[model samples]
Target: MSEEKAVEENPVTDAEATPVPEAPRPPLARRLLRSRTVRAATAAALAGALLGAGTVAWRTDTLPLAGSSAPCWDSLGSGSMDALFGDRRTEVDEQSLHDDPMGGTGAYGQCRITSYEGDRARRQVTVNVRRLDGLRGTDAQDWPREFLSSGMVSLGDGLPGMASSSRAWIALPQACTGRDDFTGPTVVDIGMGRADFEVSPDEAPRDRTALTGALIDAANGVIDGFGCSGTYREPRDLHPPVLWDSTRTSMFCGIKGLALPAAYRKELRETRASGEGGPAQVCEAGYDSDETAVRLTTVTDPALSEIYSSDALHSGAPVKGTRGYGKIGGNRAVFKALCQTGPVMFVLEQLRPAGKGSRFTFTRDLLPAYVAAEAERIGCGPQKLTLPAP
Candidate 1:
C-alpha cells in the first residue's frame, strides 16, 4: 500500500492560463451594408429610408394642420339633376356616391347636404334624411344587440321598461367634424337615443312651410311613440315627478329638446324637410352659447331616468367654469363647455339625481376633449381642466 502511494498532478501557473478570444466587429460602412438571411433585406431597408424622407418632404411642403382648405361638394347623388336637387322622391345612384369628410353615408332612406362659411370656410349646415339602406349599416349596428332584437319595450313592462328604442342619425356639419382643416362637407354625426316613431307627413302651403310642419310632425311622432301624455311642458319648464319613478329602474329616454337658435333656424327647417328627425335638441339655438340649458321630459319608467340623467350629465359638452360639483334642482352636477370656435353648435347638459349625494359617471373619459372639439367648431376658446369634485 505504501509502495502504491499515488503521484499527484499540480494546477497550472498564472502565466500558463489561456486567454479568451474577443468578438469581431465590422466597420461602419460594412455594418450598414450587412446582410441578414434574406438577400434583399439591405435593398428593402434602403428603399424604406428613401420613402420616409419623401413623406417628410411632402408633409412639410403642404398646409399646416391648423389651417388647410379642401373641397366641400365634390360628391353628389346620381339621378336626374332634378332628383338630386328636386323635391320629388327618387332613388339615389350608387355610382354617384362620394366621401364627405364631415358627413358619412345616410341610412334609412336618408340623404345629406352640407354648406360652409367663414375665413376658414367652415361648414355651417348639414341636412340629413333617413334611408332604409342607411339604417341597415349605420351606427345602429353598433347599438346593443339586445335592444335592437327586442324591438320596442313597453314602459308598462317591469324589466326593460321603455316601450321602444329607436335611433336617428343627426347630420353634423363639417365644422363639427374633428378635422384640423374645415375642407370637408358641412355636417357632424349625432345619435338620437330611444326616440319615439311616427309615420305622418302633414301638408304645408310651401316648401319652407312644409319643412317646418314636418319637423313639428316628427317631434310629435317621437312624443306619441313614447306615449307621453298629461300636458306639454315648455322647453324651460320642469315636468311632474309623478311621471318618473324614484327608483333605480329603467325608463324611456330621448333628447333634451331646446328652441332652435336664429343663427341655425333656416338650416334646421331644411334638415327637417329632409326627414332625418331634425337636429339634436341640445344643438338648437338657445343652447348654442357657452351657458348651460336644462329641461325635463317624461321617461317610460323610473330606471330610465337614472340612465337618461346619467347620459345627459355624462353626455353633451363637458362642464366649464368651476371644478367642484354644482347644484341644480337639488341634484349634484358638473359643468363642461363644448365647442369653442368655428360655426359648429355646442351644448352642455347637466346630470344629477333628485336626491342627496347624486353623481353621474361618464361613458368615456375623453368627454372633455369632445366638448373642446365642439367649441373649436364654433371658434371658441380652449378648455380648462379642473380638479375632481370632493
Candidate 2:
C-alpha cells in the first residue's frame, strides 16, 4: 500500500473564501491509496489553512482521533509488536474509517497508520480489517479466495495473509468471533513500505516478510485484547443495548428475493451518496435503486444512545416506522426506522416513476418491517423498539 503521489497537484484555493460548494472529492479508498501525494497535499492544505489564518499549530504526541466517534487502534498499539528498528523508531498514531458500498466488493474498515523513522529506513505501515459483507456469500470456506481477489491477503496457518515486497494484508475470519452481531465476512489489509518508496531486491524481501509477520502479530494481539476480532465492526449491538449505526449500505436495496431479487435487480439504475454534515450529527444517504427510486440512509449521532428517538410514528401503533414522508410518492413508499439504543436509524424509501398509471401504495408496515428485518439481519433483534411518531 505504497501511497506515492506522482501527479502534479493543483494550487490550493481558499475554501473559506469560496461561497459555492467545492467539487466532490474522489472515493476515500481510491484517494487514500494514492500514496504520499495525498498525504503531502493534505499536509500542505492544512499548513496553508493555518498560515492564511495566521494561526499557530501545536503538534501533540499520541493524538487520539479528535472529533471522531470511530474506534481507536489502541488495541494495535506500539506495545502490540516487538521493536522493528530497536530504539530508532518514532511511532505516531492514526485511526480512520472507510466504506465503499459500490466499490464492487463493498468495503468498510478501520485502520491504524504508523511510520517508523530509522537511520536504516523510514517506513510506514497501515493495518486494516474490512468486511465484504452480504456481497460475499456467508460461507467461511470461500473467504480466502474472495479476500485475495480484493488485494487483501490471508495469514496464519488457516488464516488468510497477504504481503507484497512493500505491503502485507490479510482477512480475519468471523468464525472466530462469538458476536452474532458481526454479521459479515471481513478482510484485513496490513501493508508496510519504505517511506521514500525505494526498495532493493535483497532488502525488500527480508524487510517485507518481517513487516508482514509483525502486522499479523499485531492484528492477533488486537483480537486477543478484545477476545474477538469482529468487535470493531460498526453497527454491532449486544442484546439490543445500543446500535452503533449500520456501516454496510450495499446489502440494503428495495429489498431482495430468495438470495436474489430478479424483478428488482433489473430495475437498478444508480447509487449515489449525499450528505455534508459534521461528525457528531453526520448523515449519509444514498439511492439503492433508481428505477423504483429505492433509497437508504444510516444516521449516527453522538447522543444516539441517550437522546435519539426518530420521533417517527406509524398508524398509531408506532411500529411500521416513519416515512421520508412527503419526499416521494405517487408510485412508491418512503419511511424511516429507529433500529436500536445506539439510536441507529434508517430512512428507507421508494419513489414511483412518473407515468400514466403509476400509483404508489405499499404495506403500512413496510418501514417497521425493514426495522425488524434489518435488526434481525444484523443480530440487533427482539427489543421490539420503534420511534415514537411525532
Candidate 3:
C-alpha cells in the first residue's frame, strides 16, 4: 500500500502517462487518398491528349476511327457513293496522282473502289485520272469502245463529258492544266463491272443519270485537289441511254448519207451510234451481236484528238488534204485534221480479220466517205479526202 501510494503521487510525467492516446490517428489507406482537385486535373489532361491525336488522324486519313475516308482523295463523296454503290460498304485503294517529269506520260493516277456484300465482293468501280496518251499508244485504240460507245450519253450543261450505265468520263479544263499549251488531254474516266460475273448493259446496276452525277462530282473534286478554281454544275437534262436498233436506214451508224456497204448489209444485223452531239461519236455495225465489224469514229475535242497524232504521223502512206494529215492503210485509217475547235481525229477500222471471201475494204471504201460526212456534221466541212492509189 505504501509503494502504490508513492508511485501514484509521482504520477509518470504527463508525456509518459497513457502516451497521450496518440491523438487518435486515422487509417493508412485514408491518408494515402489524393484530393478531388488533383484527380480532376489528371482526367482532363488525358482527354485533351486523346482528342488531339484523333484530330490529326482524321486529317491525315491514317485512322479508321472516323470511318472510311471519302474514297478517291475525297473526290467520291457520300452522295456519289449512295447513288453509285447503293447501301453497300466499299473499300478504296489509290495511287496518288503524280505528274510525269519528262512530260511523256503526263499526270497519271488511279483509284479502285470495291464494294462488298457480307464477305463476298459484289462490284468494282475503277477511276483513272490521266492524260490520254495517244503518242505512246496507251488507251488510244481501246478507250473509244468503252467510253465513247453508243450506250453513253452526253453529260450535258456544256460539259465535255459522257456517261453510261457502266462508264463515264470528263476532261479537265484547259485553264487549270495549261492544257492549251500541253500535248495531251488530262481526263478522269470511270468504269464499272460486276465483280463476280459478266454483266450486260440491260443488267447494269447503275443508270446513266446516276452515273452522270457521280462523274461530275468526281471531276469537281479533282479540280479542287489540283488547286484549281471553280466547280462544275450538276445537269438535270441528261438523256436516256442509247439503245441498239435494227439497221433500217441506208446510212450506216446513223450517218445521213453514208451507205451501209453491200458486204456488211447481208451479214451485219444491228447498228449502234453514240449520242447525237458530243466531243466524240461512233457508229458500229456487226452480226450476231458483235458490234465491232466496222467502226467509224470522230473525236471533235481538240484535246482528245491528240490520241491519233502519233499514228497520223507514223502509220500508213502519208495522207495529205486541205484539212489535215494522217495515214491510210488496208484495215485502219487515222486522220488528224485542223478544225475551228482544234485538231480532230477521224478513224475507220475493221476490228476483225477479213475473211477469204470478204469484199468490203474499210480504209479504201469507207474512210473517205466517213470522214467527209462526219466533218460536215461537226461544221468542219468541205473536207475532201482522196484515197491513195493501190
Candidate 4:
C-alpha cells in the first residue's frame, strides 16, 4: 500500500518507468537468426545477393525473361533487323494502317525505327505503305528521284520492285487492289534515312541480298496485314546493280537512237538508265555541276503514269497523234497514252535550258526520239507524238 500509493502519486517520469515491461518475445526464426553462427549468416547473405543479382540481370535484359519480340507490328523480325542495323538496340514508332474501302482512299501506313548505341542515335529507317499520287502532294516529284534512281536494280523474276543498299520498294499485286484507271498504284517502300541521303548518285554501294530480302519480307507482311489476295514470289533473278556509264552523242542514257545536243555532246558527262521491261524506265545524263541535266523517263505502270496527268493535260502546247494527250513546254514535256498495258507516260526534262533560243527545239526533238525508242522496247511501239505548230 505504501509503495503503490507513492508510485501513483509521483507518476515516475525519469529514464522511463520499469523498462517498458520486457516486450513480447520474437518468433523462432528471429531467435535463430539472432543466435546463428557467422558462417550460416554469411551463407544466407550470399544466397540473397545471388538472387538479387539474377533479378538485376533480368531487369537489364542481360537475361531473357521469355521470348524475343519484333517491332513495327511484327513486320520486321529480329533477324531482319539485325541484318539491317547490326547489333544496335532499336526502337520503333509507327502509325497503324488505315483502309477506307468505301472512300476509295486505299490503304496507308508508316513506321520509323531508330537504332541507338548506348544513349546516341546511330541510324534510322523509315517504311511507308501508300499509293503514289502525282496529282496531289510532292510524291510525284520526290519519289522518282529517291526510288527510281539508277543505283537500284530491278527486283526481277516478274516481281514489280527494285532494291539497293539504301532503298527498296515493291508495288502491290493488281489482283488484290483491282485496276484503278484513275489513281496511282499502292506501294511499300523502305529507305535507310540519312544513309540513303549520303550516297552519291554516280556511285552507290549496294547490299542487294539484305535489302531485297528485307523488302520482300516487309511487303509480304503488309499484304497479309492488308488481307490482300496474292503474294509476290521471292525474286531469284535480280538484275545487277545499276551503274553510271559514259555518254556519247549517238546513244544517250542507253537509248539507241536518242542523242544529246551539240552543246552538251562536247562536255564530259555520265548517264544512268534503269528499269528496263518493268514498271518504269529512267535515263538521266549530266556533266560537272549538274547531276541530271537531261532526264528522260518512261512510265509503263498505269498507276505511276498518273503522276504526269496534270502536266500532260494542262501545261504547255498540245501533243498530237496519240491515243492519249499531253503538252510540251520549253524545258519539260509530258505525254500520256493508252497502251495495251493501260496508260503510259513519256517525259523529257532539261534541268538546264538549252542555249538561249533553242529550248523549244530541244524539247521537240528529244521527246519524240525518247518516246519512239522506249515504246518499241516496252512493246508499246508504232506510237508517234508531235507538238503543235509554233
Of candidates 4 and 1, the better by TM-score = 4
Per TM-score, what order, best first?
3, 4, 2, 1
Q: Which candidate is the best by TM-score?
A: 3
lDDT of 3 at 345: 92
Clashes of each: 51, 21, 0, 0
lDDT of 1 at 311: 31
Show pairs that collide, candidate 4: none
Tens digits of per-residue lDDT, candidate 3, 142-243, equal: 787678766666776577778777788988776554453336677888888721122566655345555666676667666655555566666647776566
Candidate 1 at residue 352, lDDT? 23
Q: On residues 1-390, what C-alpha lDDT tens digit does candidate 4 reach at each position? A: 112222232121223221111124333123222311211223444456422232110111221123423444345655567667778877666544544332453456666778788999987778887777655434656787788766666776666777777888987755454345456667888888642343554434435555666676667566555443344555655676666678767877777666666766644277877757667787777664245567777888777778677778777899974566789988888888778988888888777654444343557767777777777777777668776886
Candidate 3, run of 10 with poorest lDDT: 29-38
lDDT of each: 0.22, 0.34, 0.64, 0.62
Those runs of model 4 whose alpha carbons end farther than 4 Å from true positions after fitting are: 1-69, 100-102, 134-138, 194-206, 288-290, 354-362
Judge candidate 2 at residue 192 and give its lDDT. Answer: 57
Residue-wise lDDT of candidate 2 within 128-197, one digit each (tens)? 5555333222322233222222112223232334443445544443333211231333445555553213
Show where candidate 2 strays beyond 4 Å: 1-85, 96-113, 116-121, 133-156, 177-184, 194-198, 229-390
- Please give, for residues 27-79, the per-residue lDDT of candidate 1 as tens digits: 31232122111112234445555322321101111111233211111112122
